[model samples]
Target: LETVGYTLVVNPKTCVVCMDRPREVAFELCGHFVCCAPCANSLGHGVTPARCPLCRADASHQRVMRRAASLHVATMADDHMHPPPPPPPRPPPPPLPRPPPLRPRARTTSLGPTPPPLPPPRP
Candidate 1:
């Protein structure tokens, strides 16, 4: 059997304040992770003094951490476990028809535009 892959491991302890999805969350200068782009943007934009929720470090200087691939898998698993109701059936795929054979367009402007005259040098 083929292995699915390792689930992304998010450390709750490492998460300072936000409990939102790890994938959507970003780390502040203080190393505190906040959920959602709005939250992160709000914190960074001066609405709230960015600070690490856990360490109380200055969040203003913190850089956002890119979510690791492993974290993505874990997030997917969590979503699957608590999925919302499925949407209505999608429309059927359109029928595939053979594309018309390529015909090359006639080449115009074979020599291209004439070069402009050079300007005299300044004294």
Candidate 2:
């Protein structure tokens, strides 16, 4: 008989707000993961409804609960199964307008057409 061994891996969950500490709190209504206890308290304790950083949902009235130490398991298999459609191509820029056509200017001299060039000097 042969036995196989496997190792379990757990990924650390970083706080979205602080990024340095682990995410220890979550808003009730929006269910968005937030920073450490201190940061979460400050954010959710405001007078007006505090907007969730991720989804902009109101988190002030909702309960702020601490998350238990657990592995944050996520998979991109769904993304592979149903991939998002590609964005539409950008439209081409408009063509520039053509400039007005050049017209031949009439030649005019202030001294009247020039005296016919003084006959040609006769030798």
Who wins the TM-score comparison?
2
Tens-digit lDDT string for candidate 1 (2-110): 2346665555423323544453443433223444444555654546676544444455554444556336533543343233235679999999999999999997976
lDDT of 2 by residue, 1-123 (tens): 123466533233555566666666665555555545666666755466576656666656444344443223111211122222355798998999999999999876676555665677788
Candidate 1 — which residues are off by over 4 angstroms?
A: 1-16, 23-37, 44-48, 69-123
Candidate 2 TM-score over all chains jointly: 0.39
RMSD of each: 17.7, 12.2
Poorest 10 consecutive residues by lDDT, candidate 2: 73-82
Best by lDDT: 2
In model 2, what lDDT does residue 111 have?
62
Question: Over the full model, what C-alpha lDDT does candidate 2 score relative to the true structure?
Answer: 0.52
TM-score each candidate: 0.30, 0.39
Per model, state how many residue pairs clash.
Answer: 6, 0
